[model samples]
Target chain A: MIEVKELVKSYGVTGVLRGLNLTAPNGQVLVLLGPNGAGKTTLLRILATLTKSDSGTATIHGMDVAKNGELVRQSIGVVMHSPMLYGDMTVSENLAFFARMFGLPSPDRRIAELLQRVEMDRRADIRVRLLSHGQQKRVALARAMLHSPRTLLLDEPESGLDQRARCILEGIINEFRSADRSVIMTTHQIELGLQVADSVAALERGRVALHEPASAIDIAQLQARFSEPTEALGAL
Target chain B: MAEFHSERGSGDQTETAPTSEQQDSGSPGVFVASLGVIWAIARKDLLLELRNRDVIVSIAGFVLLVFAIFTFAIDIQQADNAELVGPGVLWAGIAFAGVIGLNRAFSLEMERDTLEGLMLTPISRDLIFLGKALGNLMFLAISIAIALPVFAVLFNLVVFRLELLAIAVLLVIGFSSVGTLFAAMSVRVRAREIMLPLLFLPVVAPLLLASIEATADLVAGDSWSEMSQWLQLAIGFDIVFVIVSAVIFQFILED
Candidate 1:
């Protein structure tokens, strides 16, 4: 479980997250929806321990992120805007490096399994620089899933994924949910995000404008919420 | 949607494979774990260099170019000033070439945002610094090893002495120790090429001075006692740089 309270963050004079509160329980997919500069990536960065909040508390499995960063890192996998991969390294090599870092007992076996699952086993020897954007995204996903992190924090994970990789991604998220793990992903793909989300939360002006079960909101309503003016959702 | 197979395939799951809980239950000692992380990072760097040959090639080229230019400009055949200018030329060549290696030490990580990937690992930040520093030291040592003979032939000087080799090692150590730290700090800057030297050169100046003095004394056929003071200063600088840089590396890496 991941819980955040009163999270406030800023850059220079610009505020990104302002006393924001959120909770993501285990065994569910919480899709975060927002426009540009809406603090989605900033929020993920804080949760991933890449960026510290100016003031607030974020905990994963009751371990404070600020105080227990390494512990929190061990429990979470992050896929940011960039693939976060070494372009010069082959797919298998990249996974092996991360596996060793994670101190996995059987890296070769785990790497082979992940490569096959991600449908990149055939291209295991190909360098990341040689792969297409979608292919690289697949490898990035494979890298993220290497350590079997309990929480997967994906930011714009579907940006370059083709239809087949999207299916693979959906399958992976479903698998995580089935295993009672938590997935907190941010995306602009309304249909795909809603399709796999157990719940949806919309962010406006560094605050949660709306939070509800996925069943309570459809594509049209979510689109309307996003397209409508920010002032209209002030009371939300 | 096609079903993605389970992570644990029938033949893929092994008893040797440890879960997170199992890993915690039978974890190695902290020292061993740190060594493992450091080795993993360094090996990755070595492999990347082997594949592309960019960093080593650039460093080797730069060092050789410096040596060639210095030999012509100094006109070492004059024989009277060989000892005086030889040590300066050698150290300058190495100092500048070392910067080339140091610049790539972290910029490679920045190119594809792999540094953040590294930061996400469970390993401590100091281990990352040590690993990169170790890799940089090895690259500099290798480049210098190759360049020394070339330098000797060009300058008509003997650089194969034990004392000189030891001084070279110290130079490499001191350069990489602080170089890696500043490299990480300046990697994100837009003009990192300019920023690295601006941040690194001044700090390493004293160590360079000691190394040059020791090398000059050694080349001039002076007794050990004559150069002993300079060697001590170099050694002291290396020790302090490595410790202070390693301790504060975490801050340089943090946002």
Candidate 2:
């Protein structure tokens, strides 16, 4: 399980997350919907331990993120806007590097399995720079799943993916849910998010504007809410 | 099949996870594991360097340029200045060229945002520092290895000696330890190229001085024992900075 309470973050004088509160139960997908600068990425960064919240509490599996960062990191995986990969390295080499860092047993077997799942096994020897954006994104997803983390935090993961890659991503997220793991993803693709989300929350002005089961959210109304006039962009 | 994979993948993955006992007990298992992580990082760096030759090429090119410029500027061939100033020039040149290598260390991480990927791993920050510093030290040492012959030819001095090798190791250690830390700290700054030197050079000034003195003594045919004071200074600098840099690296990498 993942829990966040009274989360606040700021860059300089601008506030990004202002006392936001959220909870993601295990065995489900919670999709965060927010306009640009709504702190979606910032929220994921904080949860991933890539960045710290100015003031708040975030815990994964009952361990406080701030206090048990390394332990929390062991259980959580993250994919950001960029692929977060070395372009010069081959796909398999990239996976092997992370697998070694995570200290995974039988890393070669694990790498091969992940590459097959992501449909990149054929291009395993090709440098990442030679791959298309969608291909790179798929490899990034493979990298995140290398350690078999209990929670996956994906920030705009679908940005450059094609239809086929989108299907693979959905399959991966659904797999996470089926295993009783937690997946917290932020996306601008409302339809795609709603399709896979068990729960949905809309973020506005650094707080949860709306939270409900995915079945309960009215997509048209939710879209209208975010489209309405904004005071200004939040700090990104 | 998906269910099986997910279930198998879930949980602690304790095969590699460091237990509190392993950490506190300082077991051989933990020690070996730490070395493995350090090697993984260093190997990744080595692989990248081999593919692009960016860091090595830049360091080598810079060292050659420094020697060439100093060779002409000092005009040491006309007088006995080669024996007197050659050691100082060699150390100074290596020091400045090293900054180029250090600057690229973290900047490459910033380029594709892979640093965040590394940060997400469970390993401690000190290990990461060691791995990167080790890679940087190797590059510096290699450049110096190549430059020594050139230095000997340009300055007309015998640069090959066991004492010089010992001093070189100390110099590289001191350079890399502090260089890696400052490089990560300044990576995000707008003027990082300028910022790295400003941050690194002043800190390594004493190490540079000790190194130059020791090298000069070696060039003067003094025995290694006679340069003990300068060697001690260099060794002390390496130890202190390596410990301090490794300990504080976590903060430098923190958001």
Best by TM-score: 2
- Model 2 chain A scores worst on lDDT over the 10 consecutive residues at A227-236
TM-scores for chain B, in order?
0.87, 0.94
Candidate 2 lDDT over B1-255, as tens digits, reads 342264336445554745333466788889888888888888898889999888888888898899899888897977679988898889998988899988986788789989888888887777888889988988888889988899899888987888889999999999989999999989999999999999999999999999999988888889878899999999999999999999899888878
Instruction: List the global CA lDDT of all models.
Output: 0.83, 0.86
TM-scores for every predicted model: 0.92, 0.96
Q: At residue B109, what lDDT does model 1 achieve?
A: 85
- Per-residue lDDT of candidate 2, residues A1-236 (tens digit): 88999999999999999999999999999999988889899999899888889999999999888888788888888899889889899999898898777777667877788888889999999999999988999999988888888899999898888778888899999988988898999988788889999999999989999999999988779878997333211211
The docking category that best describes candidate 2 is: medium
- What are the per-residue Cα lDDT tens digits for candidate 1 across A86-182? 9988899899888777667567877888888889999999999999998999888888877777789999898888778989999999988997888
lDDT of 1: 0.83
Per-residue lDDT value at B204 in model 2: 99
Provide the global lDDT of candidate 2 against the true structure. 0.86
* Clashing pairs in model 1, backbone N/Cα/C closer than 3 A: none
Give the per-residue lDDT of model 1 (tens digit) for B45-129.
Answer: 8888888877788788898999898777776778567888989888988889888888976778888989899888766677788
Give the DockQ (2 decimals) of all models: 0.41, 0.56
